[model samples]
Each structure stands twice: as C-alpha cells, then as structure tokens.
Target: EPIVEEMRRFLDKGMELQRLVPFAEVMAELAWLGEGDRDEALHLIALAEGLAPTRAVFGGLAAWRRLLSPESDPGETDGMAEPHRLQLIGDWRAAAALWARMGAPFERALALLQGDEAAQREALDIFEALGARPVAQHVRGLLRQSGVSGIARGPRQATRANQAGLTQRQMEVLQLIERGFSNKKIAAHMAISPKTVDHHVSAVLGKLEAVSRGEAAAAARASGLV
Candidate 1:
C-alpha cells in the first residue's frame, strides 16, 4: 500500500492532529526508505514539520535523511525520543526491547527488522502473525539480502486453516467487528496497522459470505465461528 494512502486513513479517522503528526513523520520516513513515493514523502515531511516543529520531530526527520544519505552525519540524538533514536542508530535490539515493554508488538517487530538475521526472522513471524503483508514482504527482502535461505513463500499454514480459513489476525478482527468496534479501534486493540486490519476485515467478510460487518457478525455467531 502507498504510505500516503495509509496516512490518509489515519487522517480520515478523526484522530487528534497531535497524535497524527508522528504518524505522518513515520510514513514519510517509510516512503523514503521503502521504495515508496519520494515526492509524497517530502510533502508529508514538510507538512508534519510545519505542524509540529518539535526538536524530537526534527531529530527524527534528520535521522531519516541521514539514513537516505549516509555520508551526511545524523547529528546528536540528544533531542530525539529514545525509541526513535535507538532505531535510527541501528540499535534495534534495544529498541525492540523498549517497544516490547511498551506493549507495541508491531513496533517491536519493526525494530527487530534492523537487527541480525535471527532477529529479522522473528520480525517476519510477528509481521505475518499480525497480517502485515507489506511489512512482512519488506522483512523477506531484508532476509534475502542477508543471504538467509529457505524463507517461507506464503502465509503460515495455521493462518490458512484456522476457524473456517480465518487467519488468527482475521479472527481477532472478526471478533472486534462482532463487538461493533470500528476499524480504528480494532487497529488500536491489535497493535497492528489499520491497513492490516482492513485486509483482515475484507477477508473475514469474504469468508463469511456477508455483505457487511453486522451481517458477518450474525453469520459468525450463527455458525459458532466467533
């Protein structure tokens, strides 16, 4: 998915502008690093920096720029947040531990992706378990670049066979839908990207043969799938 598209989803959810500013920075950084849209990334970075010109945010933007052009020094990490500084400095093991303590599985996995092959493998598993296909693909690319062999070429088998073909993440999304949780709520509860939640929701609807979330919930209850 386009980084801007995901960023737009966050904006459409009516979250606080302050809370969303960081995500804009994150998506901009991802775009710069992950073969996403450079022009959009620059636009987003400009917008976010204009909105929240905090030292922490500036440090993050500067760090990402340094990553893109390694010869330029990534100046002092004095003002950057601990997690952002750790990940940008390639100390992903420490960053992963910090995210784990904070109960952010997706972020922890992202940090792990910056570590050794073993750590990257764990990151891959976490991404797949969360149904974050885009990040999982990115992790796969990293593993391949590191000369690791025998990586699985598809979703885990358990994800394919569980609960009438509902992946574990999909089942979680379905249960949340049954409880009338919006996609944003489900994303928050699962600690995964809203984009991943969207994919799971679509899959759940398709597998349950329902036209809407309410109908899907009713079918799931009628069939004991939830």
Candidate 2:
C-alpha cells in the first residue's frame, strides 16, 4: 500500500515532467504486483494505456496487460495477441521468439517458462544471470510446483555488447571509434559512405548519452562494450 502510494507520487512527478514512459513502466510493475487482483490490475492497465503512445510499443507491456482483462478482444491488437494465444495453447516457444524480437525480456522469459522443460530451465538461467533474484526465485518455484529439477547454475554472464540499445552497425562503428578510427576510416572498413558512418556515430553517441565520440568510446571500453 505504501509502495503504491509512493508510485502514485512518482507518476505525478513524471506527468509534471511530461515524461510518460515512467508512468507506463510503473503501471506495468503495479500490474505485475497485483497479479490476481484483477480490478486493481485493470485500473493500472488503463492508466498505462493512457500514457502509452499506442496500444503497442512499450514493447509487450500493453499486450501483457490486455491478457489480464476479463473481456478480451483478439481483434483489438490487430493480430498482436497471436503470441499470447500461442502461449495459452502451450506453444510458448513460438511466442518466445516474438517477445524476443519485440525486446520484451519479461514476456520472453514467461513464454520460455511454458515452452518446455529445457526452455523453463533457460528462463530461470536468464533470470539468475541478470541477478533478477525475485524473478529467478519465481521461476524456480514454478519448476518445483511442476516437479521439475536439475537446473544447472552456470556462470552468470549477460552479454553487455550493444547493451546501450545500439544496432549492429552502430556497435561496429562504436568498436572502430574505440580503436581510435575516424569517420572516413570507419566508412572504408564498413564499405559505407562517410555520411552514413557519421549518422551512425551520432546515433551511437546519443544512445550512449555521451557528448563526444571520445567519451562514448571511453564509456564503451569501461563497460566492456567495445
């Protein structure tokens, strides 16, 4: 209750700042917390929908919320609900790919948990590797509930390359920048025009929140991204 009240305040602050994503994210987290509290969950979902630019593209957050509705409309998402439908029918492996492509990590993990025993283990491993203690515990509990066992606790290594949400070409350009290459040199290596490389460099810098190439390169190297 206290957390809910605090989150409401945070939501207000985000609104005041004209930043909608935090409101949507907080609503998603609240929805997840409410779980079987359908009324509360739907209320949170409505709030998120108001903040979201569209019914899509808070990635799968809106889709996940839509799944919790008592009266579902398959047509509402324009076939986007197919993944959830597949997930419901024990075809979660198919759904997992969609979630992964959508960059929805939580949805991907959920789909994987329902896919198969190996995939369930994989979901747990992913949670553990991310140091997502609550989610990992939840996955482990789910396995125990289903009489599943023998999950190997392998090394926890989350790939950080392009973790700044960089595209493949941006990642390549970033690596070159870290190696002290100029735009022309990077263009020659990638066989693209210098103008294209400049765009990518600017994109990479913006994504990394760096003011200059040097700072971005230093950040990439420090974060093991380069």
Candidate 3:
C-alpha cells in the first residue's frame, strides 16, 4: 500500500502541474499494483482520467479495467483508443470480450480482423457464447474479405522458404530494411559491415522483384514471407 500511496502523491503532484505524462505513469503503476483490487483500481483510474482526460490516461485506464473485467461495457469509454491499446499489448482476448460486451458488430469484426487467428477465433467464440450470430456473421464476412475462408482457427504453421531464394542472412537484411533501420544499425545487429548490409538489401530487393525496399517488404508480407 506504500507504493499506492506514493503513486497517489505523484498523481496529485502531476495534476497540480497539469503534466499528463507523469500522471499517466503513476496511474499505470497504480493499475499494476491494484490488480486484485479492481474496484479500487477503477476508482483511481476514474480519478486519473478526471484529472486530465487525455487520450493516454483514458486509454490506459480503460485497458486496465477491460483486462480485469472483460465483460464490462466497451462504450463506457469513448473512441477506439482503448481497444487499440489492448490490441497493441496483445491482450486480444480482453479486447474481443469488451467488443462483445458492447454488442457492436462492426467493431467486433474490426477487432477480429486486426488480431491473429487464435484471437479471431477466440472473439468469434465469445460472440457465439453471447448468442450474437449477426456479429459472428459480420466477422466471417471480414475474414472472407481478407481472403480467409472462415474464422482463423489456430496459429499458422511456419514453412521453410525456398532455399533457392534469399538466404537467412538476406532475409534478416530485408526485415531490417523494412523496419527502416539504417545501414549502421543493421551492421550492428548482424555483426557485419554497413557495406555488406547494403549489398544484402540490394540482393533481397532484386530477388523479390520489387523496385524499392518498401515495395519489397509489402510483397514479402503479402506472400507471407515475413
């Protein structure tokens, strides 16, 4: 409880300063500490949001509460910020549950599409459990739009790429390039020369038949190479 008390003091100070970042950090610490004490956490989160209704604090507080109680109403908060936060943190189950609770078919479909297969299936299952057939059907439609036949059932198995294509070293270079890493950073990661990294990137681009590195990355992702 000392930590909570300390966090509260910090929260107050941050509010007095009208500084949102410190207040957001303290609210996050409080949420983490108040894991089993969800009612207290919710109260603290409400206070934090009331202090500065900024997107960061609102999203973080909503995410913490949704993680703690997924069946709570998603519309209790405004906008897509909280849902996106949950997705970014890989708390897809809770995100799905919140969407289900809100009974928003389009939002549920979007959540399922943005998540991995396991998460999509889990969201569908939750919708089914809620007896939300229309939502489930919407989700199925989204999957079909993405060229996927039905709800993603499980994780896709990794397959070995054609050895005749780019080598593992080339793939590494390609991934780094796509991530916008500079030659020096790529060299540090691969323990190679900047020149060598540049050469590998060129090779990857040529092999992928793409004009630009960005295009090559898009092609790779489309081909399920990355």
Measured on C-alpha atoms, candidate 3 has an lDDT of 0.58
Leading candidate by TM-score: 1
RMSD of each: 9.8, 14.8, 15.4
lDDT tens digits by residue: candidate 2, 1-226: 3344455567666553234445444545434432224455556555555665543443354445544552454234533366775665456788899888888777788788766789988888777667665456546656887898775534443466534556566788899999999999988887776655766787678668899999999999888896
Q: Tell me the TM-score of model 1.
A: 0.52
Error of 1 at 36 (Å): 3.5
Write down the lDDT of every candidate, Cα atoms only: 0.70, 0.64, 0.58
Predicted candidate 3 versus true structure: per-residue lDDT over 56-164, tens digit per residue:
5466555555544556553334454656566546566666667768876545544564577666666676665665543454455445666766454322324433321
Span of ten consecutive residues with least summed lDDT in model 1: 154-163
- RMSD over all Cα atoms, model 1: 9.8
Off by over 4 Å in 1: 1-23, 26-35, 46-52, 58-73, 156-226
Ranking by TM-score: 1, 2, 3
Residue 37 lDDT, candidate 3, scale 0-100: 40
Off by over 4 Å in 2: 1-7, 10-24, 30-39, 47-54, 57-59, 66-75, 79-91, 98-107, 149-226
Each prediction's TM-score versus the true structure: 0.52, 0.44, 0.30
The candidate 3 region of ten consecutive residues with least summed lDDT is 155-164
